[model samples]
Target: MNSLFHDRVRGLNQAPLRPHAQYVLYWSQMNRRVSGNHALAHAISLANSLKLPLLVYEALTCTYRQANRRLHTFILEGVPETAKRLAALGAGYVFYLRARKSDSNNTLYRLAENAAALITDDYPTFIAAQHNSSVPAKLSIPYLAVDSSCVIPMNRFEKREYAAYTIRPKVHRLLPEYLKPWDMPVLRQRWNLPLPAFHTEVTAGNIDALVASCEIDHSVAPSLTFRGGALEAEKRLAVFLDRNLRRYSTDRNHPAAHATSNLSPYLHFGMISALDVALAVERHGLENNLSSAEFLEEMIVRRELAFNFARYAGRQTECLSSLPDWARRTLLAHATDERKPCYSREQFERALTHDDIWNATQKELLLRGKMHGYYRMYWGKKIIEWSPTCQDALETMIYLHDKYALDGRDPNTYTGILWCFGLHDRPWGERSIFGQIRFMSYDGMKRKTDSAAYLREIAWLESTGCEPHPLQ
Candidate 1:
């Protein structure tokens, strides 16, 4: 077996380099928190090995594609708190660069110059992958990518998994070795490198000021309810474990019940590690309990399966053409099926559709930056049915999801969208619009749970708080 450091870390595929750079640099992109972070732990190990300090740097640039109210606010919530935590860890430096139109490139270059080695969060989908691929080519130092997001790291699986069942046994087989708690590494010695003073403090207080000053789209303002940060992420986890987790197996499907762990935003932003959550759930004595086991299956096995898909399969964003041959053929046969009320992408986005339940799910996603897990599948499948073509529906789903959902653009999002096109899912009875693709509808949703209660909760959310808007 390859060394964990060699196989898991990026830029190690190259030859050994001369030791000239000062500190180990962790370019904070995805995993943003200090606790239970494998990437940070690995960086500390490398830093200690080199007898150097660890410098953790993060950049909040406005140039990312479709970066709007939901994305910006969710990311900003974790920044200042993360900086403070890293400072407490005796890190050589923790700096956050606010990228206005003029300064994005300068920030990256500045950090790259002072670092011995660069380590960043390993994310397959979205612009982060682009950054990971480009930075190593341009830099003189070694660049390492760490997998801190999934409980079973994406690299653990070699190929695109066929389904959750195919991957579940593999993940369970290795859980004893990897799922154990990671010991927090204590910094052995502090390097006397000069700390770079930050020019601006981008905490929650200055979020509005920062957003107002920027050139970003003003249409999709931040949701007042779902602010991102480590503290809030921890709080939500506690609430889930204390209240909802025991009932998760039964209550999770009910959209009205707040039984689901609302940790996606934190997971998306890297505010909390998946291992941390799993450890907490285990420590809560849910290991022997059936409900706990079921919950863990979804959280660990199914979730990591999504990560495996994105890491191995490059076509996670394309239309039906990107799906497995079985899926593509099935969808093609349903291309011209008659529909009662097909809607365009714009119609779906504006919540102008005829179905109240579908519109309610959209409204929920818009207002809360998330949706109930069960409803999310139904939500995507309906979009596939309503759009003019399978390709159009796939594009529309990815666009809306990546733009608004807090967990959008992650492996799970792509996998969930792909599930609509029959990836990681079994074929159901033949249907019209969906063909062999899994079909979900108002009728199926109603049979599954209390549709009326879900509708009432969504209506309440829409009327009481911040208005839902598309990320322009």
Candidate 2:
């Protein structure tokens, strides 16, 4: 393999490549796109070196924790584009939809049976993380995991970073070398074999029917706002560059402004690469004479800090125990603080809270499958203030995100939710329910943000099932 991708790749197993293997298998566990994928590029390099055809395998199963119409539809919608791209690259493509728990689950192992070496995505959280940890040892051939998710590879940081400030300088120091465009290598050998029997063909028209046929949660519908696939992701990125990049630094925190790029779902699902977005934004900013600093801070430094947290924290990423000493002690000290008008999980899920701002945030998650970052902080803080206990509040946040947010079960999701409980943060003035943890009040949100406009927008979305404006 080329030394350019050395830091991004990690060999997960000791097994040698199968001597008589027909092709190299690249499993699309995450980093699903054909462009800007270091793992796929690395696989092509390996395949070319071995003079073997490359085969790419992707799957969506009903077995993951919150399999539902919303999640399944988004993933399935991306399949046709992926198939087309892979085919154009002269690589074989296979997508398997295990619509039922009883369906065959040995697809990866079966594919590996003929593989020279197995290449997969190296993600720090969600199902990808779990699979990376356990699946490597089970494979007979070498299993290599690549860090294609971050602009600066996650492996560069040896330990969990304390905060964005600690990691920012390091990220900047390395940006010149890592932020350049990825040159995906051409395949030397073309795949000519027919696709496997388990391959489930996905098309733009059959996505809804495919999602409907799945025996997963039927109640939660697809987002009324965002669609899945690389095409949609690219379109949204183009819109941000043309209309919103200049305004992003000023109005990203203001939910109603719609200045921020609504690309978290794309990022989480790997439909779009962070490197691709960062490069585009930086180039646009340079040509147009606008500062990309603020946007890149969130994209690289802060976002990678979350990946660093998940990398070291491991299974504790979602738990309160992973919090710093000050945060845990402070929360434990205030554990018994009474929550006036406390709410149950059901009430929170149904958006039945008395706080209009909080309810609006929840409604945004329901309708758009994501909430604006600024209000999400308020939404989480209010949940901490209203739930019966701190643990209950954490559970509510995770449950809601897992069930509704398109960006749920992601490193950013865990980091953002845990931010409500003071992870990667400092102590503030002592408070009632929140103690030293920072507090967000209804009046504070009203004073700082365009809460009235946000409420009006959410109300319109709920009533009409459509975005109130073209900007959104």
lDDT per residue for candidate 2 within 1-472, as digits (tens), equals 8788999998999999999999999999888899999899999999999999999999999988878999898888899999999999999999999988889999999999999999999999989999999999999999999999999999999988888778998999999999998689999999998888999989888998888889999899999998888999999999999999999999999999999999999999899999999999999999999999999999998889999999999999999999999999999998898899999999999999999999999999988999999999999998899999989999999999999999899999999999899988999999887889998889999998999999999999999998987636
- What's the residue-level lDDT of 2 in candidate 1? 21
Clashes of each: 1, 0
Please provide, for model 1 over 232-314, each residue's C-alpha lDDT reduced to its tens digit, 9 standing for 90 to 100. 88988888877788888788888677778878878888888888898888878455453568678888998888888877777
Error of 2 at 19 (Å): 0.5
Clashing residue pairs in candidate 2 are none
Q: Alpha-carbon error at 413 in model 1, in Å?
A: 0.5
Candidate 2 has a TM-score of 0.99
**Model 2: residue 297 alpha-carbon error in angstroms:** 0.4
lDDT values of the candidates? 0.77, 0.93
lDDT of 1: 0.77
lDDT winner: 2
Worst 10 residues of 1 by lDDT: 463-472
Quick one: RMSD of model 1? 3.3
